[model samples]
Target chain A: MYICLMYSKEIVKGTLKPIVLKLLKEHGRMYGYEITQNVKALTEGKIQITEGALYPLLHKLQAEGVLQTESEKMGKRVRKYYKLSQSGEAVADDLISEMLDFMQTLKSVLNPDYGQA
Target chain B: MYICLMYSKEIVKGTLKPIVLKLLKEHGRMYGYEITQNVKALTEGKIQITEGALYPLLHKLQAEGVLQTESEKMGKRVRKYYKLSQSGEAVADDLISEMLDFMQTLKSVLNPDYGQA
Candidate 1:
């Protein structure tokens, strides 16, 4: 099961930061589980953002000042929600643009019909 | 100059293997310099594959049995050209498919009009 996911994992790892930022931008704020579930649902179970990969990225974004977190008590447990900071919003936009450009380049490369090579 | 390329480098680093494989699949055999130039030309100088990044990946692919190399003397210098092996061809196909799927997922995520949240 896990072995089958190697390719997806590699692709996701590269785009994870932008994906998280884009989600945060759209939703305003999202907790870890919500983020993971949203991604799973959006990708139709083809891509799963595991806790192991998600937490460190969240932490890294927080460290980089691209994300801010708010913790709210949900009964006995605390739910930490993440949202993009001002700089994060700018970063998200830049990331999306960069990703789009990259996809375009890749599309040209992948589709020889484009005759780019 | 180098700083302007940070985003592009990050994106390219993630997709380099597939890009290289695709290029090899199309061209049959290519030397390191030729591969680098091809990528630079294809991306319109937006992405540059530095020697530092390209060599290790090529070696890794060869070690994984996904690439085979042939050395020929071009004047006084020996030029190494790489091509996909049998397993390499299969891997290249899988990688291209995976990359395409990834781009689709990214397109949906990046496009707010998609309402994919």
Candidate 2:
């Protein structure tokens, strides 16, 4: 039985950071599972951030100074919560603003009814 | 010139590639000047992507197989045109869909009026 998987690797490579940064930017802080669940809920099961992809992104974010981690004991497992760093907050604002602008530009180009490109 | 700039480096570092990818994802293909001009037009002068940064990203995207380039001679400049590669198209779809989902998740967390985080 071939279980056709949906999320492709190339997509993950390109978008992992922005998605993760955007998450930390808004939520203040969240554990690994929480991030995954948030993505699942928002995407309505159409999109998911796998552990393999999510953890590495968290680590990279920490390395880049865009994220920080705190430990919280949740029952048995001590979960590491990811949050935005001081620099991360500034980044979030810039990213969100730029993206919104990009969306408008894209709408103009991709869906010409929005605006003439 | 104590020209206080709006686009901070941290913001640029965090958002550079996604913004570029998002741009290429929407517009079929465009050159360096066009990309800068496109960003300017959409941003209404609020955001500007410099050539130093833009070229490196275009080169990196090409390296990553998410973009392919063709040369177009316009007046004195032989501009390189970037389009989604075979994988880039799949990557773009996945990136766009995933980002929209992430945006919803972020709205719930940041805005709260959208949904519960």
Candidate 3:
């Protein structure tokens, strides 16, 4: 059976980080679950960030000093909220710019009529 | 000193296969150097495909039956050409659609104002 997906896993994999960063840029300080829900709702379930993928990337971004986190007591568990650090804000801006430019380039490559090439 | 690049290596890395596939779809069979030059010209030198990256991807796609290659003797050396296989055409079409959709999703993520979100 051929199952149609709105987007491919490969495309999703490459863009996950930027998606997270941009969401945080738009809506400041989001908890992990909030991030997931926000993305799900925003993309209409076309783009779901698995916990396996999201947490590690969050951790890595934190480790790289690009992200900051704070925890609040939520009943028996601590709920962590994440936000971009100042450096992360800069990184996000740079990445967003790069991503947009890359999209234009890819569009040109796919549809040469769209470009001067 | 921060040197601005037209696109990041990471973005280029992820899109390379689709770029190659799309070019072949537009221009028919192409050899390795020709592919590189076509990308260079098309992207206006913004997206250069390094041999180290391009060859491995070509070989991998060939192995996966997504691409077919034909080699011709060029005097002292043999020149190899690549095109989408019959199945590869379908794959390329699917990927191009997915990539375009993913680009829209990514644009929405980056610029929520543009989306219904």
Candidate 4:
């Protein structure tokens, strides 16, 4: 089995929102760059959250009231941090549960003996 | 945690291709309705593959040369069965491996202690 370190863009794209929400929930607040770096470090470079996918998702979450942003002055640049809103906290919980269930379904589909006794 | 019996359509949509490919690889060939019923039965009704999503995927796979269709006549109806082509066998292996890796990534994201000893 050839298990590559890098994942296909489509697979990463589908899971991006829940991944972002979960990361923010765990760490409280994170900027865009930090989220990307954290994901890369945690996945050991198996997954890379690209700017094209991350920024738009953050903006969409903000527009949907699931995330709120705060800006801080860092030397000569402004760093924007994202945190889950009250409703977003609820959404994060739901997304985590949903993803977990989805993973189980994937397991059963891939491995016939996954849930078999 | 409300783990509903039905998964969100979006999650199912993202995973449909690999699921279909794997099923075809495992069972040799299957028709549209049979595929849906097998998934429902295997997942214990947790996931449902809808026609709206399944047909277009089958057609796309056929057009892409990954799947070949055979029409068999049974009484008053002609049932179309799908089987993986030669290239599709290789693709199926790749997809299964990719899905497994992707599930591992999801595990690490959803559970921080996943890869920790």
Q: Give me the candidate number with maximum DockQ.
A: 4
- Give Cα distance to truth, residue B2, candidate 2, Å: 21
Best by TM-score: 4
User: For residues B1-117, what per-residue lDDT tens digits would candidate 3 score against the true structure?
Assistant: 223445667766578878889988987899989999989988778888899989999999999999999999989999999999999999998888777777767787787675334
User: Tens digit of lDDT per residue, candidate 3, span A3-113?
Assistant: 345566776767888889998988889999999999999888889889999999999999999999999998999999999999999999888878777776788778667
lDDT of 2 by residue, B3-25 (tens): 22244444334345555667777
Candidate 4, CAPRI quality class derived from DockQ: medium
Question: Can you write out model 2's per-residue Cα lDDT over A1-117, one digit (the tens) per residue?
Answer: 112234444433444455666777767998889998986775455457789888887888789998888998879989898899899898776665554444344344333453342
Off by over 4 Å in 1: A1-7, A114-117, B1-6, B112-117
Ranking by DockQ: 4, 3, 1, 2
Chain A alone, model 4, TM-score? 0.93
Interface RMSD (Å) of candidate 2: 7.9
lDDT of 2 at B29: 86
Scored by lDDT, the top model is 4
Worst 10 residues of 1 chain B by lDDT: B1-10
Candidate closer to the true structure by lDDT (higher is better), 1 or 4: 4
Candidate DockQ values, in order, are 0.49, 0.10, 0.53, 0.66
DockQ-derived CAPRI band for the predicted complex in model 1:
acceptable
How well does candidate 1 reproduce the true complex, by DockQ?
A: 0.49
RMSD of each: 3.9, 7.4, 3.2, 1.7
In model 3, which runs have C-alpha deviations exceeding 4 angstroms? A1-4, A115-117, B1-4, B115-117
